[model samples]
Target: MSPQPVLLPRRHWLAGSGAALAAAALARTGPAAAAGETPAPGAAGATKPLPAYAAWKDPSSLIVHSSNTIETRRSAFGTGVITPFGQLYVRNNLPAPDASILAERDAWQISIEGVKNPRQLTLGELKRMGIETTAMVLQCSGNGRSYFPDKPGGTPWQVGAAGCVLWSGVPVRWVVDALGGVDPGMAYLTGTGGEKLPDGIDPKSVIVERSVPASAMADAMLAWEMNGVPIPLAHGGPLRLVVPGYTGVNSVKYVKRLAFTARESDARIMTHGYRLSPPGGKGDPSQPSVQEMSVKSWINGPGTDGTRLKAADVQIHGVAFGGMHAVAKVEVSLDAGKTWQLARLAGPDLGRFAWRQFVFAARLPAGQFTLASRATDAVGNVQPEQRMENAGGYNNTSWADHAVKVSVA
Candidate 1:
């Protein structure tokens, strides 16, 4: 069948104003000492306080992982924008205060409200709460934002706007139950982080407060461990919120408080930002933007050096993901953008929220070439080349197929 034809208006805001508020909050909480900086270390050049939506602007901080042994043209994927030694994505909630300011052990506390007997728990108390582990892919809603056809109003994001890691922590329901179960009429559960925003930015803007229905709280988790250890301070140490299948914006980081209420929260951070135009333009003004991740795939191997391969057998590999559903198919193309074929898939075991690995092996002919891949879900949702326009920076549904230059020896 021919490629699906969809018209995505050109004017959409990829990042939400709430994201800016979160960034501004981090800047005001005081500079996170340079020690925890991940990717680039101490090489400070263009390191400026990021706007709420500009989380992935720092290039040096991106985490790079490649399976191919090629060293000349390195292939890797990052969680977000590259910062000093790690990648940055504008998180909807504020970051935790630096260890230097709060001291890892004594700096944070978790408060549970709206229960019959609310209580405050420290990180140590939380550790004893029977922690469960899950491997999840934490991605910004605007991960491949730059790919969006140039438009006004959106956060600037490159390909490295997402990351996958094993997360470990206490389930949100566990904490709520420990506080003597929730009361009736509770429809929203709000989470608060410990970080503060900069001087000029509005505190109302920086403090991220979002609420989910009590029914959804059963699945919400408070993660403290990542990839087998306590989550790094830079990555929301002590505690963070993990709401699987929802856009990263709803997964608040640096979690400090949880409140159950009968009414939906009026936090501007949750209501006004990260929202997409509802299907058929009938938007739900009351519902928050907590939809499943859209299907997406990326080409990450055989960079500049692939150009030297002779017209022989070649291995093309990349990654694919569909928020909560199984990736039913992944198609690849080699002739610029003409014909297409299926690629081998691996890794549905990583859970519904993780990215799957895929590969296509074919005999390439001696000539210049272009390559691309598109992923489809079991729900019949094929990845789109673009998305419908909106004001916030929410570009989750756009296709990320890439064209790389290669030559045969």
Candidate 2:
């Protein structure tokens, strides 16, 4: 995947650029077809394979939006709370660095500033300071953008652009303390990616640097591992910064510079990108940065592929999570949003930052039905009925748009 900016509308970006090839590939191989199941004869572009860089991923489990922006298939979720690395989504803001950098992962170094004793520390040294594991939702800011009526620019991702995964690394707090802590006035924790930049273009125009509230450091980490294994290059290997509960972008990949700053970074990505604005509005410095995700849930089973089911007991199940809070309960609706029933929360509670798998047992006769799930966090943040209209379609926690229709024979 090559580095590209998100400046054009979805149609223009997908149809006007080579990325169209990737989208075309997804169309020819629907979820079933990609999974090697029986498919209609002569599906368009069905013979194509995932980009060479991402060949390690299971094409059957993901929908390729572009070489750099692959998404998990809805059916590939498989009712599991911890998404396997093979099935996780990939959304890169810049092309990944050569994998050769990972030959000696422990030697990877990151510069830490705004501390009393600022210095560059290698991954090996940071790991020696302290290490912890955290389970959180890694969701793209535009996860449900396709549900937007205006169809914003960027990948028209669905719920599949998110997953709950475990991250292991040295807590940012530990690193700071080891380096004598941050300066008194630091207000933001900023991270800069290590991807190479275009030769003639100003670095600020394409660099991926984001700054989150300094308070987030309590839950942040400079992670070297994902799902218990050393992170893969496509998913930010060698080293990455993890900011739990925030949008995936905040967790900078190939992180090289991490600092406690007095102000947020002035990079274009921070000033003109990822901001929340009114529908059809242009991103500006006045807008808020897309950060913590909102509570969201979507039905994943009784397959939305319109498969006919025998009239009997059916298990309607899916996943739900409160962005930064623990989910208090999840309610399911069988007939769209008209009525709701409390669904059983299944599986061990991974953590507040992680999603919970929920299951609802329903008895049905031969017919059709719309299924939806609503989640409420411990703080009483209920999943909304409608997604707020926005310029970029960033955070869409709307239940109505994500509801699934099922055919029962």
lDDT of 1 by residue, 1-409 (tens): 2222111111111143323322332233222223222222121312444433233333333322211000101143321211211333333334446556335653468888899998888877876776665545567765554444543243444444565555667788888777788988788777766776678866656577766666767557888765444565556666888876566666777778888888755666665655664432422445346445777776655543232666778778777777756577898888755788999885334455666778888888887777777889767788776565544446545543345567776
Question: Could you tell me how far off, in angstroms, the CA of residue 123 lies in candidate 2 after the best superposition?
Answer: 0.8
Residues 1-409, candidate 2, lDDT per residue (tens digit)? 2111112222343355323322332233233412322221122322356676678777777777777887777777776667776678899999888889899999999999999999999999988887666778899999888888787878878777898776778889988988898999999999999998989988999999999999999888888977667888988989999998899999999999998999999999999899998988988889989998889999888755446678899899999988888888999998999999999999767678888999999997888888999999888889999998889889999999999877788
- Which 10 residues in a row give candidate 2 its minimum summed lDDT? 1-10
TM-score of each: 0.72, 0.89
lDDT of 1: 0.57
Strongest candidate by lDDT = 2
Candidate 2: segments with Cα more than 4 A from true spot: 1-48
Clashes of 2: 0
